[model samples]
Target: MDVNTTTGLSAASALTGVEVVERKGAGHPDTLADGVAEAISRAYSRYCLKEFGANLHHNTDKTSLLGGAADVRFGHGELTAPIQVLVNGRITAALGDHTIPVADIVTTAARDYLARALPLLDTPRWVDVRPRLTQASSPGAVNAPDTAEREASRQRWFAPRSLDDLAERHRMFSNDSSAGVAYWPLGIGEQLAVGIEAHLTGEAFRTEHPYYGTDIKVMVVRHGVRVQLTACVPQIARETPDLDTYIARRAQARNLIAELAGTIAPEHHVTVCVNTRDVDTRPELYLTATGSSIESGDEGVVGRGNRANGLISMFRPWSAEGVSGKNPVYHVGKLYNLAAAEAARRLHEETGLDCAVALVSQSGRDLTDPWQAIVQTSGPNAILASRARRVIADVMEDLGTLREQLLDGKLATA
Candidate 1:
């Protein structure tokens, strides 16, 4: 296939008019679902590897979060009902005669993930986790003839199935095949939006300002060189003494964001707004007992949050496929997304041009080989184009390593 080096307007150049980008914080319900699903998948993979010598066939991507009700006052709040967390999927629960604690493992992983992601949330007190997982049977397991003669005939024709054969068969017959898309060289606006959100909700910021909740969002609107940031941050009720204190904290956060934004892009004029919905007169605030919107009737479903790169870019091509909770080994939905991102990043670095990559994989094909792989660049420079092709080829060659990184938890899928 020929590499198309025809470039479009770079993300930076495309920001001449008003462009908007959004990012969901780590504690947001949809993000929570993604995190929980990935955590469960990782734990299950580890368990299967330790006991069964291979990762099991499981797709735990259907997790959901049902928001809980809460009553908030000036300085405190109470949860009327615990947040309902349901994990739905299929897994290998038994290997030969040994039974794997699938539910227990998933439940523990979910609770631990919530505790880590939303430190302000009293997970045990406000979160109720339920596992609705089942063992995934092979395609013909239930209908296969039980007679010894039939079994002998089947073996004679099929012979002994290897692990790779089983994995390929599972991939071929699975209904969850998907393509992964990513682009590189994020625009200044995109970077600022994602960066500001990360700074505000990051560990250092959280440690300094304990009242700031994990459920924070950042929206960026850029017109030419001017950038505007709107952030929705939840304040923990216990840490806030009253409405006045909350207002003061919000002001401080806003100022800090402006200061940080200036450092990020000094040439651009940046404006910051924090929690615009807050009205002191009405005493309406974004306060939470657990520091998450999930306690306030905001439902979240998996794959509805940010992509693997952590920013939802409207100016660039994006994919809605959720990479988390899919199989780590050969699941193209997961591998191709991560691969495309890396490929785009490398191509941009090597060629100094804005790059976009789309990788599509057919069911049961080799993970490294995509059915349709396209590398689009922002300009038509032959020398740079050649370099971009080399970078993409190198990235494709490294696709096999992605599975290891994913299974080891070294990559962030959410």
Candidate 2:
């Protein structure tokens, strides 16, 4: 929550920027990364080629799926290019010789679809993919005990690649401490609400429902918006450079970023959504599924406890190798653009209001580079939940604003 400007309401009208870090490998999530890269390569080689173009001769996903996911972006020139997935025999674990990683395969396939998708978009090229294998378990608790901690001596620490800390800005916009734009609330038309449930308590905030998506609840209370988009972002990783046609399609989607950033504000709306269908795991890193919660640092969600899992590294954001990697930057930019487009569409269609909008989000944690210290974050599962939150918030706020404008213009007729 970084305050960029003050609104009429107060000095707290700050925009948000979101980021998250997820490790790879068995204990972490690199295994999943490997699968995604290889899957993307294979799919690109097969379908994306001979159709989109023919520059794709043979593809090799060199991405070590077991490593983890990198940064995520939403709105504006966040991304500059496409991703490169690398693959090899090492990254493929659960496969019984013929089976490919489910998430990886489909994700890459999805990229292929987006290549020629309806909205027509442009996507950067994902080049130089590399995949590797490891014998780690899954990423679990961040706070390791004695024996487990000792065993972790061999375990490497990775930081958040894409996530950022925005408590300040979020605080300002949330409570109207910063100046904000005016707000004209719309009736909670079964689409939005306000308030929140205590974390893990399942208690709705005084029945204050701000908005709801296919999954997760939302509310705008305490002078700010609270949302929970809780869908499992499939851990199944995927990428493709061979799929130039799909890349072209992705590129087509880039336009929406600007459209949205021009509208929405820092207050008055919140939304959450999720989809936890696919999960990519790495048992080798920390396969055990048992551990306790270990809290650490300020403004950072470090998963510490146990269960042979590597979990999201709380290390510095943007400091991780994979996070700074090129493919992730491309992917983050790609999704941000897609979400922006959706926001614009919603502004016009839902409320019939005319206004520009922008999305501001901040991941729960921060990315610390220069390793050295402890670790950091989430990609697929929790990642999707995070993204959905951002996407829904942007869309809902714009819609709400648009609706208000329409009512003013007597445009409320069916």
Candidate 3:
């Protein structure tokens, strides 16, 4: 592998001008898509492992959610049209003579996730779960020579006859060319952004403020030590009886965010704003029936919201690969991102310095190694470079544990 170690300004230190960070709450449409896709992936992996003794090849990262139409009033609201969720991806639906219940798996997972994500919505009444899975291989697979080896490979691509037909069980290989980027030590602005969103969508907050919905978003813009925090959160129609209550709830949310920010970063002066679009003259508000914009025609797609890391930092290096719904066993897009993040965290712990890591994988390479590995430290020190490399090596070697964590839904993806 090609290893490069260098010294440079870390992402936090490089924040010279205005830095922007965003965090989407659990009920956001894009986050919903990501959560559902990941749920399906984990459910399918568990089923395949339990039934067939191996995880099947599948990439369910292409999931999408089309928002439903809703009619809302002061104290009542309902979905006029059902929301449509398309779980689209490739999967090995069959093994030998037994056909895996792909429909049951996808829909069950979708319903289970929706029930948890949007507690106010009746999933069975207002949501439609559609499984659009296929068992097709990549077009390039057909270009191989007409030999016995090619036949064996094709068998393992999607429709494996038995455990012997699964090649990854012996030795896992990277399936795509991709890169994973990660950095350690979340800045104060990042922490506040994430914390505000979590507090607004959390069960404790929701229990007290049932008028506030889960469809929440926090944006933090920092100029030096002063931070401006803006949030867009939906007010539940059932809990909000009138315009006054809605306005009051919005103000309450704003104050809560400001208080939470102070707790998270007392050094930074944070100004909070909520529902900037709301106007005194307008009767309409950022209200929802189910506490989510998805109940009112706001669509969502996987990979369009948060990155593998929860917060989206504008100044930090980011990878386009969506970690959720990816195969945890061999897909470098998922494994490498998780690895790079863990490596950065370990390096920071070991050296007491901010760390950044980038790992690139070539198709067909061993999963334990990457084609290129780059490590950067906040300060200039050659000795720290060696220490960073060792920390990264340890992370790469522990990918097996990472895979298990991923299958168990223990890791945060998106």
If scored against the real structure, what TM-score would every candidate get? 0.89, 0.19, 0.96
In the range 1-414, model 1's lDDT, one tens digit per residue, is 245455554555454656678899988899999988999998988887887677756778888999998877767877888888898877766654567788788988888888899775678888888888765443443344652234222222122233432434333322334677888788888888778888888899888988888888999989998888999988888788887899899998899889999998788899899999988898888988888899888988888888888888787777888877887766677877888899888877776777788877766455555666677776654335466567666877786588778877788886
Query: Order of candidates by lDDT, top first?
Result: 3, 1, 2
lDDT (tens digit, per residue) of candidate 2 on 67-136: 1112221111111233333343222222112333434554554344323220111322422233443324
Query: What's the lDDT for residue 183 in model 3?
Result: 87
Off by over 4 Å in 3: 11-17, 143-152, 382-385
Return whichever of 2 and 3 wins on TM-score: 3
Candidate 2 residue spans exceeding 4 A from truth: 1-11, 14-83, 87-92, 95-414
Question: 2 or 3, which is superior by lDDT?
Answer: 3
Candidate 3 residues 120-186, lDDT tens each?
7888888899888888876445554553254347546788877776767767778888999998888
For model 2 the TM-score comes to 0.19
Model 3 vs. true fold: TM = 0.96
Task: Output candidate 3 Cα RMSD.
Answer: 1.8
